[model samples]
Target: MALPWFVKRYPDLNFPVSFPPELLSHIIRDVCYNHDPRHPAFRRACCRMTLVSRAWQAVANSTPSLWRYLLVEYSTSQLHLAAFLRNSGEAPLFLCFRANAPIAADPDMVRQSLLESAVYISHTIRRWVAIDVELKDASVFHSVLLYLASLPSPPLRVLRLACAVPRHADRRSSFAYGFHGPTLRQLALDGAPPWSSPSPPTVALTRLSLHQCSWPNYSDFFEFVSLTSALRHLSIGTVRFAGTLPATVVHLPSLDHVDLLFGSNVDSIPVVASLFSRLTYPALLEVAISFNGYGSVSEFLRTPLAFRASSARLSGICSIDEDFADVYHRLFGVVTLDLSHGQRAMVSALSAEKSHALPLPSLSTLLLYMPNWRSLLDVISSRNDGQLAPLHLRCNYPEHLAVTHHLPHIADHDLESHHRVLSLVSSFSWIHPM
Candidate 1:
């Protein structure tokens, strides 16, 4: 057979001949993580890469790092499990296992399959850097947690456990494992109580998210919070406290972001307010709060619960709640105010307040989702001294047109009709919808 001159010169050719094995391995890792539509899952991408050729197969098999993150499925065979572990070597692993069966599948079969897989992986808990276990059946969760608890404290960086199914009181004993490892940085517990073990000696945790947890009392939650001195982000979703928060305040020097979502009609305002007053964030930046029942957050916004954060976004604070605008009078340094979820009547009330004219001295960017653009414009005009940053109007096209159309019409009394407010309005450029 005759061949081209270049082909004859090289003789041995590769499909992707230009890239070395290391470079090819790197490219494969990138592609797997990119999670392209063609290869939506990392395992799927890895499987496809292995079929490319002997060269690729060798590369994939030798790349221990590539097999570290595993999403164990019921269909995964023992051979496949062994191969993944063998290839992963000593690299830290991230595992996500859910012992949930499909509608068509038998529950017993699914449980048995998960038990087999869990038994195999439990021995390698030392290598687990992060793990997420979600189970709808409490029996299945208890079985899994029993094996997990038997292991020594894992070198876990992040751990998320969600057991949505109800279980007997005795079932909680299975998850009495302690996570006092120095590297534990993030902890998220759903339908799980705060662990009874001693707190980590190192306060290295930077993020904590508690979702529907059953804490014994406010003291327990506060005690847990006190341990995480290095916490920067905290999210509490529908967590009800049975007892009043302690009079002692917990200062988090590094905290900057907080998200609080209270359950509807739970009367959590006292708990939330006490928690707010307790914590002092000198460097706090952003806070978002959503309360189900509305007496307005005005009471919480008063002095003891004041936010030093430059940005605040409150949801469910109705218009009729007077003194809402009065709260901002203390936040003289707040540069951005997000009232997108604020009521139209509240915006009007804010605009009409005589004290609103000089309340927020540093407020430059005002974000609103109200239909009353004129009222907001009036509020902006009322500001005594501050650089008018662009008004971020998150509204429909009609509202946008109306705002732009009416910006020029300033009342004789508004901003003294000196054209200063109009000039400020002229500087505004419609921001793309966020």
Candidate 2:
């Protein structure tokens, strides 16, 4: 085989006629630092590189960035853990501790290991830029919380806590305390853990997600949102807000996306509406809402004036209770429209308009959920204008099999119609017998 141009030009640079040491060093550094820390591929690649040779092993061990993310478990040795942290040098650290792990077959050993790991991690808490912890027992979690309470605000940017204890666990009070990270921007809490202190300073978070987290009262929840002045994205799932929403509007100047979901509560719609009414987020661009409460979606829809007037986009609206007015149709400019589960009467209402104002001009995807073949054909026939952008039609009923027979002849089988038409027929059974 012929030598490459670089190898030929600099004979001394070639090490065993392959990768130069300088190039190899750069590649290894990039692989370890740039790859996603959570991906298994990262660990697999690093492990493979270490087996290459003693030179590669030395390089991997000396690279401070490679050991920055540590998973301290019961099986992890204190000596090895200390060496890993020391090798990480001054690089910002990401630490994860699972306090519920059992050590060997002994429960006493497990407790001792948990205590030892928490104490060791606390000593290095100032080096942590992000922390994720999982604690199941109330007593162990309370002890860990004390160490976390003493954490001095360093470069901590993300904190995620998952407590698997029961809702009535005594340690819940300790979990309610706030972290003291001056740079914390993202916080996620799951399984009923209170993530903030009693008097949390105004932290300008950009993203906040809460799943099944309980607050002391409605005021506390509102106060938390108010303090996050730089918040841009917020997600709430199955989190209940008690008492009436504050009348005062809280403005989030940078907010761009909001997602609210509800699983239980008869007053979900009103509660969601009340929350929306209290916020003024002029920069919002996308919104998603799911509620199984009393009243139709229209009630919640009417609450957010910003959603309608602002240039907000949605994935798709998928509820069909009653036909909404044309004004609602005019407000939406979504690229993908899923009206399959929506009321069929909406098509009639839209077709009856004399203006034919092209309500969904931006629409590129349309789904039809019809009772029979003829209804689907009727709706498709009503849209005679070929000026529409290319469309993808998805049919949800088996009876609409007849559609394929006549689809080729639609619009007189014109070239423009063929180019504009795209059909996606469902092979599965999502349609029920009416």
Candidate 3:
């Protein structure tokens, strides 16, 4: 058979030519990364891409950059997760293992698998910057910690463990174990009392998030914070303590931002105000107080806390605890007030008198939710502050992450959120990352 017209015209080119290395790289990226269900390559062709040659497949299967943000939201069993972890030589930045199934495996196996996988993840932890892992069961926390302790590189920067974790499975195995998370900066632990101990997590963490937890009494809270001399940022949601926040908590020199999510029993107006007055957040920039997961907003008159706040954000200050509202107005320097969660929200007082209306000397951004077009427009158009360069208006939902272009006026951007999550789960063929 004769060559095609195009092939005949180009005499310099080989008859049945493959792409050059540079072109091949681009082509492979498109096929491996851009290909979808409808318009796709054959199944065999996908596998054949790897077998094209050893060196090519090596490039095809592994891209060091892609390992930075790995999300393991696998729908498979723990055993499968363990197997994959055992083989995954590349380190991932982020990994999420979400399995809500009831406890089905032996305690030791479950714990061991989690430990091994965590160890594997830790190997990459040094390479990548941040990690957000979710495990459903609390039984395997020891394993996770054990593995986390083994990482020799990259300090664990920010860690959010929303999934429950067992506190101590081997009590007799010596309760004197403690890991100094020199690299750990931000930590969010949402678990029960039965699952953890009162030994005090002594990580050099700055940002700490407490949600749906087991710190029932002041002693527990004290013990937890005792190890947090470097603690700065704290976010609390739904807790019923019999006593007040310890004096030591307020004494922490580094403590700054506190996101308080008040439970029905814990939401006291006077106490809320005292938390603001008593503590020291010299560099404290924002305060996002939510109630029952609902975001709220308030206009506060100039106060010590408000004046210092360059970008104070109070989202989900539910039902407007009248007592706290009084203190909220004094926030003078606040530049942003996010009230996206408008439903089930009641502010303490929003003065109709424009003159009396609390002014944010630095205020520039406002986030609000709207039902109709008119509301959206009104919210968008309401920002008169010339300094407010970018005003982001998002829907008002309790749990939903209000997506908008407006981020913190300050830097220290949340790169973790911007990272590509889905790429980690899929095959590594497409990645040409640096």
The 0-to-1 C-alpha lDDT of every candidate, in the order given, reads 0.44, 0.43, 0.38
TM-score against native, each model: 0.56, 0.52, 0.45
Per-residue lDDT of candidate 1, residues 1-434 (tens digit): 23323334443432223332221132222223334324445455544453213433443465544443444333434223433344444422444343223211333543345433444444434333333335554344434434443334432322333344234422422221211212211221111122344433222345665545455676766655555455677766555567666788766546677666555535555656766777777776766666534544666566344455556656654443555555654653443444656556556665554434343333345555555667766554444232333343444324354455444332222111232222122333221111
Query: After superposing candidate 1, which stretches have Cα over 4 Å from the reference?
Result: 1-37, 40-68, 73-126, 135-154, 163-206, 210-214, 226-230, 247-253, 280-282, 303-305, 308-310, 335-337, 351-364, 370-375, 378-434
Q: In candidate 2, what are the lDDT values of residues 1-434, reduced to their tens digit?
A: 23323234444431322222222211222233445444665555545452213334443466545544443333434333333343444422444443333223333443345434434433444433243345544344334444343434332332433334344533323332222222222221111112233333223245665545454556656655555455666765555665766667776555666665554554656766776677776666666554423244455456674254333322224443344333345444443344543435445534454424544444444556555436545654445444433445555555444554544323322121234333553211111112
Superposed by TM-score, candidate 1 places the C-alpha of residue 408 at a distance from the truth, in angstroms, of 6.7
- After superposing candidate 3, which stretches have Cα over 4 Å from the reference? 1-111, 116-132, 137-159, 164-207, 222-233, 242-258, 263-282, 292-310, 315-326, 335-368, 371-434
Q: Distance from true position, residue 187, model 1, in Å? A: 14
List candidate 2 stretches off by more than 4 Å: 1-59, 62-65, 73-126, 134-152, 162-206, 211-215, 226-230, 262-264, 291-295, 305-323, 330-336, 339-378, 384-434
For candidate 1, what is the lDDT? Answer: 0.44
Between prediction 2 and prediction 3, which has the larger lDDT? 2
As for model 1, its CA RMSD to the true structure in angstroms is: 14.6
